[model samples]
Target: MPYKARVYVTLRASVLDPAGTAVQKAIQEQMNVEIQSVRIGKFIEIFLDSPDQTKAHQTIQQICEQFLANPVIEDFCFELDEIPRVSNLASQG
Candidate 1:
């Protein structure tokens, strides 16, 4: 079966986010609403096929830890879903 993984990479809480702070200030001024804080992050989507769900989970974890996120400053998490197999309805016609 095939799986789709959604990954989110974020700066560690102790790390400062200048970009996010700038955006927050801009938004507060433009909208005239009080805003406490904002943090910037990355969103990544990956599609892969594996023999089983367990393998898919492991692969996604390795990919995130090794390639997608930086361990020292960035933290990462992922959500996995099995891609549904749908029949070709048009071909049936």
Candidate 2:
């Protein structure tokens, strides 16, 4: 079976995000809304083939911790789902 995983990486609350601050300023100026703050993050989607759900979960965790996210400043999380194969007839109908 094949699986799709979505990973989200976000900067820690203590870390400052200049880009996000800039966007917040722009929004406040343009919309005249009293927005307190804004934070930016990254989203990543990965598709892989794995039969063992347990192993897949562990692998995703490692990937996020080791490569996808920066432990020093960023935090990460992921969601995994199995892809359901569609038959030809299902598509035609």
Candidate 3:
């Protein structure tokens, strides 16, 4: 079966997001508004074939640990969905 996974990567709360801060500053300066805070994150979608849901989750977790996210300063969350198999016979019926 084919599974779809979504990964969310975000900077740790203790870490400062320079890019987000810069954007917030720009907005404040240009738009004349005061902003409390800003946070930036990334979302990734992956599709893979697996025999079972557990294996699919393990694969995605490994991918995230190895390359998708930086464990030192970032945190990640993932969700997986199994693809529904379509049958030609069902269509005919």
Q: Pick the candidate with the highest TM-score.
A: 1
Summarize candidate 3's per-residue lDDT along 1-93 as a digit string, tens digits. Answer: 999999999999999999999999999999999999989999999999999999999999999999989999999999999999999999999
TM-score of each: 0.94, 0.90, 0.85
Q: How far is candidate 1 from the true structure (C-alpha RMSD, Å)?
A: 1.1
* Model 3: ten consecutive residues of lowest lDDT: 33-42
Task: Estimate every model's Cα lDDT from 0 to 1.
Answer: 0.97, 0.93, 0.96
Clashing pairs in 2: none
The lowest-lDDT stretch of 10 consecutive residues in candidate 2 is: 47-56
Instruction: Report the lDDT tens digits of candidate 1 across residue range 1-93.
Output: 989999999999999999999999999999999999999999999999999999999999999999999999999999999999876996797
Better of 1 and 2 by TM-score: 1
Local error of candidate 1 at 60, Å?
0.4
Task: Judging by TM-score, tell me the better candidate of 1 and 3.
Answer: 1
Q: Candidate 1 or 3, higher lDDT?
A: 1
lDDT of 2 at 89: 100
